[model samples]
Target chain A: MKFLEPGLIALDVEAADGAAAIRAAGQLLVDAGAAESRYIDAMVASFEEKGPYFVLAPQIALPHAKPEDGVKEASVSLVRLREPVVFGHAKNDPVALVFALGASSSEEHITMLRKLTTLLNNPAHVQQLKDAPTPEAIGQLLEATTN
Target chain B: MKIICVCGLGQGTSLILRMNVENVLKDLGVSADVDHMDVSSASGTQADYIITNNELAQSLQGHAAKIVIVNNYFDLEEIKSSLQEVL
Candidate 1:
């Protein structure tokens, strides 16, 4: 029941800009075999087309593209940036955490999203995730969140 | 009550907003049927309220449902205060 794997998790990654951060997150999905390389391009295109609407919370972002964008599996990659980067979101700027979603279908994405929503709704759990020391710690935090 | 959370992609951020809204409603002891939809399908959908970000709020103009612009999608207090006026 683990949506995040240690290999796909990056803590305090350094990026030049928001796009770089997104690319780094997308790379995790690529490395995990969840998504193809074009999926990263699609994510960037989606961000350009949709603006900062992907910033779901004050310090969190959920970047994704259409399922047709080249998803090979249903999963998500977690990226914690060393320094927050701005994605033009007026209210929620300088995002520190990025959750890149890659799903083979809408249903798969929705199912994963429901679990994510439950985990993120609790501020305490979110703080735990943000302050997690290692990828193992992050995985443990997510494990505690699963019902 | 019926509420539809709208976002550009619908499945990603909208789902989170919908979850948050549902939690707020439950805390208020109110019953509601909440749904999530993309911006493309949102305008034609039927609902009492359409919750979305400030950007999409403008995009959904002239829609049937009352638009609720939620700036901070995760801010339960802001969402509660805004829903208080309408719900």
Candidate 2:
């Protein structure tokens, strides 16, 4: 089962800032038909209002908005940036990995979070994602997490 | 004790943190009603502890519940230690 569409996976992306990085990630969801374009704006606004709390770990970010924001379907997307962007997070700054989630309900969100946390808790798996040579390699890493 | 995990979106990162917090609390034999909430709505809710990162912790500084700032949400040890300090 492929939760992350092949088109949604990108490697070595260039982003100017954290919001730009999030936008790039969110765009993947848009292309996959999982989220509306306005969802990107909601994600950006949420980040601006609540600060960089989405920076889950060092070099990683999980950017998302409320289910009511603009979710068309439940999905997750990943973006690996060529250059890390400063998100103003104290410990987790200069994030190079962005994970954007679009869920239609809180249940879906929680379920996805459960799987994501399992993957994130392992430092080695996260390192693999950071050092993934290609988008396909990144997809394989994420697929392992889903299972 | 009711603990609320506050984040930008109620269901994303905060929910993940909530799960880790639940696990750590279980290991320590600490029982509490842990909830996940969004930053804006979290202000009005009641909780014994409001667990969040430094960014959102600022918004919840004066809340009645004790605010625990977690620098690394994925670091279970760090989370366990932080909870040990206040719990």
Candidate 3:
């Protein structure tokens, strides 16, 4: 299955930092029926404890919590930041995109993580995501990655 | 067999990295088990090696396990080389 389908986008988030973006993205994943509501808090707590590796590359963030924290399903939540947020890492560049993930088990989670990482590795796609203006546009961008 | 423990704030990302490491080990025909531990509990574990990103590995200094800090967990080539060196 395509990890990120059209319904996963929650565009135009107004989070001031990585922590808030994680919470918002987690909530969206829950609302999209991809994860349990409790997973949102767990994801936020992980960020609080670990700082943000989610801020992998410039302007990109991929925040996630553990499966044991309470994941009902496997899915991803995408949020485009209105303004960049500093996550306090050495790569403390402001984060413009947030992709919060939820998985039911370790093996399944890792598979999705691999795909997401491969996607993020593409500079061209990252640039497109940064420039996409609407949720629909973001969805199209993700869909294009599937090919 | 070398055992590598990969921990994150929780075990989520650690587990993902562990799986990737496991795949790398398999391809190399190396005998190893890459396990996941929560960052809180990772300090107490006994392991032959520890593979993690800069942030978490920084806090695990002077542990019994030899730590290898990776720039990104998804970088399979880097992880494979580090594991080979430790083994």
* CAPRI docking class of candidate 3: acceptable
Measured with C-alpha atoms, the lDDT of residue A20 in candidate 3 is 84
Model 3 Cα lDDT, one tens digit per residue, A17-102: 67788888887787777777888888888788767765645676678876677777767778888888888767436777888878
Q: After superposition, how far is residue B63 of candidate 3 from its true place, in Å?
A: 1.1
What lDDT tens digits, residue by residue, belong to model 1 across residues A59-87? 89889887788888888899999999999
Interface RMSD of 3: 3.1
Candidates 1 and 3 compared: the better one by lDDT is 1
Per-candidate Cα lDDT values, in order, are 0.85, 0.85, 0.71
The CA lDDT at B8 in model 3 is 62
How much is the lDDT of residue A72 in candidate 2? 82
- Model 1's CAPRI class is medium
RMSD of each: 1.9, 1.8, 3.5
Model 1 lDDT per residue over B1-87, tens place: 789999998767787788889889999999989999899998888888999988678889998899988887767898999999887
lDDT of 2 by residue, A33-114 (tens): 8888999999999888778888988898989887788898777888999999999989899899898988667566666777
- Model 2: TM-score for chain B: 0.96
Expressed as tens digits, the lDDT of each residue in B1-87 for candidate 2 is: 899999876777888899999999999998899999887799999888999998778777778999998888889999999999998
